[model samples]
Target: MHIKERLFGKTAGKEVMAITLTNRSGASITAMTYGASLLEWSVPDKAGKFDNITLAFDNLEDYVTHRPFYGATVGRVAGRVAHGSFEIDGDPYQLETNQETNHLHGGNSGLDTKVWDYQTEQDDQEARIIFSYLDAEGSNRYPGNLKIQVTYTFTEDNKWKINYQAETDAPTLFNPTNHVYFNLHGTVSKTILDHQLFVDADRFVELNEQSIPTGRRPDVAGPPFDFRTARLTSQATESTHPQTLQVSGLDHPFVLNHDANRLDVSLYDPQSGRKITMKTSEPVVVIFMHNGASPLKIANNPIPAYAGITLETQDYPDAINQAHFGSIVLRPGETYRSETTYSFHIE
Candidate 1:
């Protein structure tokens, strides 16, 4: 195994660094300190050709100007919070409503936009990069000073693992996830409609027109939402179901039926014979199919609609307000931990 680091660019007067970790099998993943973002995951397909399967910009200027979550670490909370209002221990706190009337992706300046401190480690079997950030208390109007560490591990067997750990000085909400969009065909010009997906979920959180949860957990027994068995992504994207039509694609959070020993999700592209099997400790997986074309270009090619898909394993959005959505509160003296693993292979 080997690791390399290079200067990526300058952002906010701070130098951003890109770290690449490679295993003996010729597979590698690269991450940047800016946003603690993932830039590349190059692996061989059935034909032994390597290609990056994630959506990413070629330069730092584009990432700074055009913001799609694209492989960035999303936090304070991963999804929308209703009206950006929540109470902690009877004290009501209001956050910036960056998205219409909801607080989306931790507000205008979330973890995804920050440059983090990092350290690297490696052994005979694996390589790792740890990215750390300090979220000051009252920043974006959230409580507590949060010290967070995000670790990415690349294994010799082609597994990409993420482990998140955090501690807060006071009561606060903490729910984070990585927003990496994957197009197994290795290019953003190609849509993911042909990819097959399987999600081990029986129900999904229902959202309103504003995309905030309506406190409903609807069963996924029929078309569109059902993914209990592997099915083409087009089966959901091309459907006329109200839920599918509402967002122009699949963007709902499905409550996961978690099993420590079982893989909970799988995505495969038959054309490339590449597959990703995922397992997470989180209770939900938000499946987002890129619903519209991106103005940005990848490798000089225009990004098309449904160019990629995100399997964001995270806690349910707006959990603080929804009684059944569970709690995301991290109080003093408590340690928060979440982990997810994605294994790649040729089908």
Candidate 2:
């Protein structure tokens, strides 16, 4: 089953806001263009009941107005950069810092503000919503007349396949990803303290006091950072680190088995009978615990702080500033392409 038919509504300036993709197994995923975010992921629960597992809101305005970063398509650079400055072609450039002295989520006017193009193809086992933007050189204070596109597709294989591509006119840095707060428990305030998790990386990025890279790659085998086996999120949260106070949860970058064109991650929630496998074509995975405060907008809503648990599949955060770390540079003839697939199954 896939998008059987797509309809265009009368209002809303001709944007394809609501799209549904049906899996071969009949499971479905929904997406909206307001933030170019995945709105709901409906999969089987423990008792075989279909439930929306992704934490979401009731309407489109919730996405546009919510500062919670609920399900956002982030770009330019997704994570934080110390003082929002990066060196491109041996020139140091500073970006607009929205989060204090730190540049966060690509500054104030990031990708979330733009609307994407959508097409519900008849042959696709999925529906895709695409967003394209042209960033002139030095737009984000980075050197590039960048043309970028981020596509979110829901496949019949039970995968949310997110693909990103960009080509820069000048030498610059680009790290883009979808910042989705995933919880198998379904949007609650409970500490993910007991949720068991695992990863296949041996080393992680060490950070300074402001969540900036210290330029040190540390081993995970002996620390609470190690999640090669099934381990609880609380264990990593309670462990010791040099910059523990800066990032409360697991807000570190893990060096992955690299590829010239891919990045991937696999996560599962046993209690909910949901298994999510993420695959991408990138060098670094910024795994954040979302341990940061929610700044919860709804005053009375019982929803607690949600963990980002994001596998930010891209170059390292603040990569433009670190020479030893790799750069996300693409030449005139080069095309920047990255794909991440999130496949879901019930155990």
Q: Please, what is the whole-model Cα lDDT of each candidate in the order they appear?
A: 0.93, 0.69
lDDT of 1 by residue, 167-270 (tens): 99999999999999999999876799999999999999888999889999999998898999999999877799988899998999999988666579999999
Q: Which residue pairs in candidate 1 collide?
A: none
Where does the lowest 10-residue lDDT sum fall in candidate 1? 254-263
Best-performing candidate as measured by TM-score: 1
Q: TM-score for model 1?
A: 0.99
Q: CA shift at 162, candidate 2, in angstroms?
A: 1.2
Backbone clash count, each prediction separately: 0, 11
**Mind giving the per-residue lDDT tens digits that candidate 2 earns over 222-304?**
65778766677677667766444466667788887644343245666777777776666777787777675554433234565
